[model samples]
Target: MTEEDSLRETRMPSLRIMAKNTRDVMKEPILQSILEKSILTKTQLETLLIDLVIEDEFENHISYKEKASLRSKAASRSRGVSRGAFNRTLNQARKNITRCFYTMLLLAYLGLFEFTFFSPFEELATRIEGYRRIRDTLAGKTDLSSEEIESYQSAERTILSALDSLSTSLSLKSRLSRRKTGSEIESER
Candidate 1:
């Protein structure tokens, strides 16, 4: 086998493990709802994740063509697109991420981010981070009592419900309803 083929063969197991873990995370109801409501599509998120894995996980840096192939395999896509398409999706994901940051900056600049209104968003972020840590902790434990398992499950369910509710509340429709209209502001002035 060629050197590149041998390298790919060695990487397959790690790639598959990553893909399975990513799939499991994406299957969470809260994550599914958030993805559905977010600017990035699954393909775009998958593309970005694959790109990061390829870049950060390997000893040797890979080319765009190889990255594209790896992305297709990781996603289990039957009909994989070309490198160009993968690059396009990666760019789109990056653009969406940048736009989100800019939007937050604009909100801060306008002095529109009141603690009363934005605290929930911050809390949601903290909860999501904590949930990830909890999952990681649970996954690392090879042996656990039934009670412990049950406790983890209960916590997961409670967090999922809270996450879903927080996501729903942060939706555009909900935000718009809570905001004052231009006319309302003018009338107040």
Candidate 2:
């Protein structure tokens, strides 16, 4: 085979693997629930993940054009988008991420983090990391014993339960919709 043909053959499998992994991650239950509640839109999340994958998978820096092309390919886009479109989405994703951090900072400054209400968020973060570790360990193995499969399933259920609990805690009540006038606030003080 010609050098060009050989290169194409090797590149195809890695590209396919990247596409498959992207799809699988999007389908994950925890991620699906989080995305539904997240500030970033689904398209923005996909764009952000693709950008991160490009940074992590490439040892050397690549041009924006190349990054955009790879991002499209990894996302399994039928036709690659122009670099401008991809860059726009990436920028939106970054803005949402920055805003989220700023909001967190505001909450901390208000001393809200000291309350028990925010403790679940910290727990959820730790649980999510543990879930990822369990998933990665299982994903690396070609074959798994029944015990390993059961252990992974248990971990999945535990994380899902924790997520559900957190969701319930954050849900707004009907009474919370009532508007209080400035006089009412002063009266409470």
Candidate 3:
């Protein structure tokens, strides 16, 4: 088999698993509610979820051939989806997710502050503080040193980005093990 073929052979199962996992996540009540409240139609939400899952799975593949094959698979799967439409939907979904998260955090912060005599919302308060610091720095209200700005950036990247990276890593590992088992069985044959 050509290298491209071999890579695809290894990656197809990964892609399938990624799609399944994405579907599972999308079926969650929280996600469903988020989708309902967002601008994305049902079809657009489905497409965006699948694309995110597949893209995350393919993000860390070491070889260009593997990446290209995966991208081709994604393109074919999303056939008839205009690049502009997909990107717009994806961006909207991201904004919606972020807005939802912030709203939740705000509610939690308010509740904790209202109910507790002491400072029970320390973690949430810290997050809010960090968010404000970043916002202020960006708005030129706070003159952050380079290191401080980097620290804020790192903190911001840790939340959503880390979750995404962790999910991708977990899914890739799961699929790789399945691929190895399949390869071993084929070799035995």
Candidate 4:
């Protein structure tokens, strides 16, 4: 087998594991709660996830192609889709997934932040402004001040840290539950 083929074989399992972890993370209650409070429905979230996964696969495939020798590339071209078409699809998918994820994160952050304030209108306005800033920043239409950027980055970091801790706990619980079930089955056998 070619070195590129061997590398791709080794990479597949890691990609599978990452996909599984992403699936597990999406099923998490915290994520569900956030989604409930967001503009996106469960179906929309699933669609975004699907797009993200497909984009990731396409990017990985492109990377593999970039690393392969000219002969291998020529051989693969006969079996592969047009690179230009693939790239356009990948870019579209990436944009969709990114927009959805950013919106979800902003909504979740606003939801969490709203609870600390007493006035509903004030919180609503805050959310609207935050979303505007996010949209503008993402579109490259406006530059964020240092303070604004720092606050946004801090919120993102805090949310990610919380999710990481929750994921770790959930993983441990799943592993322990599986072990318990295995032991019970062994005892019965």
Candidate 5:
């Protein structure tokens, strides 16, 4: 093959398997099979595993029944899916559920706080036709009436306050692991 063709064919290795200065005794064939089948990406697979702990602890809540059903459906569909692909889909579904759960909590908090759904800016935008009316009205002018100026300011305040309250909702870091659980873990069957 030409050098260009060879270069084009090169692929990056998955980061999870990379190790430095040492090697483990086990190859983890089951995980390898999952990867080969496209059950999930390494990152997403890790998330699902981590979140599974949290999700399991939450089984007493409302969604355990629904998710169990969904998992059954996913199991049926995943029969044809490779490990990586199945992992990707499962991770996305998990992220969606996680997001929805947290979002509902945030919304409930906002409701308790009696926060306005539409801030002054949004109200103004509606009244002004989505900023167009204000833009056209003030295109040639530098000053604004009190009501006219409050719209944008109100929106900014609402968004800032909402974000400030939701700041706790965002978490980006995660702990990594080789084995998903303790050695006692076994097949469901």
Candidate 6:
């Protein structure tokens, strides 16, 4: 053999020795614990991993009759228990339907109120515009005289004051209602 070929063959033995030494060093710490916990040989572990792969690939499982038997057993149990459960389910469904209908009515009422009566800014704008137009109409009048103008002004002031009082009372009522509702929910919880 050539000198280079002999040297290469000589190096392979030491290389194998080094690799085996490294493997033993790495496995030494874990070996005792694994041996204590499991009775499987290396071959048995390999076989089990192979079987799991095969099962996943092939979709192999219990017999169809066994599955049908389990399903029937489950159905029988449900039938036994559902005899008493039907009435409660029916009653709860009826109650839910009633509550849904009532909610619809309440929403309709709220929508109507919103459309007809809840335009605060528009109402205030219209009322103020009416007062302004009346004042403008009475401004250049010489036939009204001083006494009639004074009386009309007094009446306008009274009506405006009453409207302001009504707005304040409505605001307070809304605030108090919200506070009461919060307290009631807190008490219930």
Candidate No. with top TM-score = 1
Question: How well does candidate 1 score on lDDT at residue 38?
Answer: 88
Cα lDDT tens digits, model 2, 59-164, are 4444455445555444565635679988998899999999999998998899878776666678889888888898899899999999988988887788788777
Global lDDT scores for all candidate models: 0.73, 0.72, 0.55, 0.51, 0.41, 0.45
- Candidate 5, residues 51-168: lDDT per residue as tens digits? 3543444333313222222221232432123445545566685776688678768867777324343243244335435444444566567887888678755644544454444333
- Worst-scoring 10-residue span by lDDT in model 5: 14-23
* Evaluation by lDDT, superior candidate among 2 and 5: 2
lDDT of 3: 0.55
Per-residue error (Å), model 2, residue 81: 1.3
Off by over 4 Å in 2: 1-16, 72-79, 169-189
Q: Rank the candidates by TM-score, best first.
A: 1, 2, 3, 4, 6, 5
Indicate the worst ten consecutive residues by lDDT in candidate 2.
169-178
After superposition, which runs of candidate 3 have C-alpha atoms over 4 Å from their true positions? 1-17, 24-41, 58-80, 112-189
TM-score of each: 0.75, 0.74, 0.34, 0.29, 0.21, 0.24
Error of 6 at 42 (Å): 96
The alpha-carbon lDDT assigned to residue 150 of candidate 5 equals 89
Candidate 6 lDDT at 173 equals 42
lDDT tens digits by residue: candidate 3, 8-76: 787677775665666566664434644564566665566665565566666744332232222212334
Q: List the residue pairs that clash in candidate 2.
A: none
1 versus 6: better lDDT goes to: 1
Q: Model 3, 113: alpha-carbon shift in Å?
A: 8.1
Q: Candidate 3: RMSD over Cα atoms?
A: 20.4
Instruction: Give the per-residue lDDT of model 4 (tens digit) for 13-35.
Output: 56545545555656755466456
lDDT of 4 at 86: 39
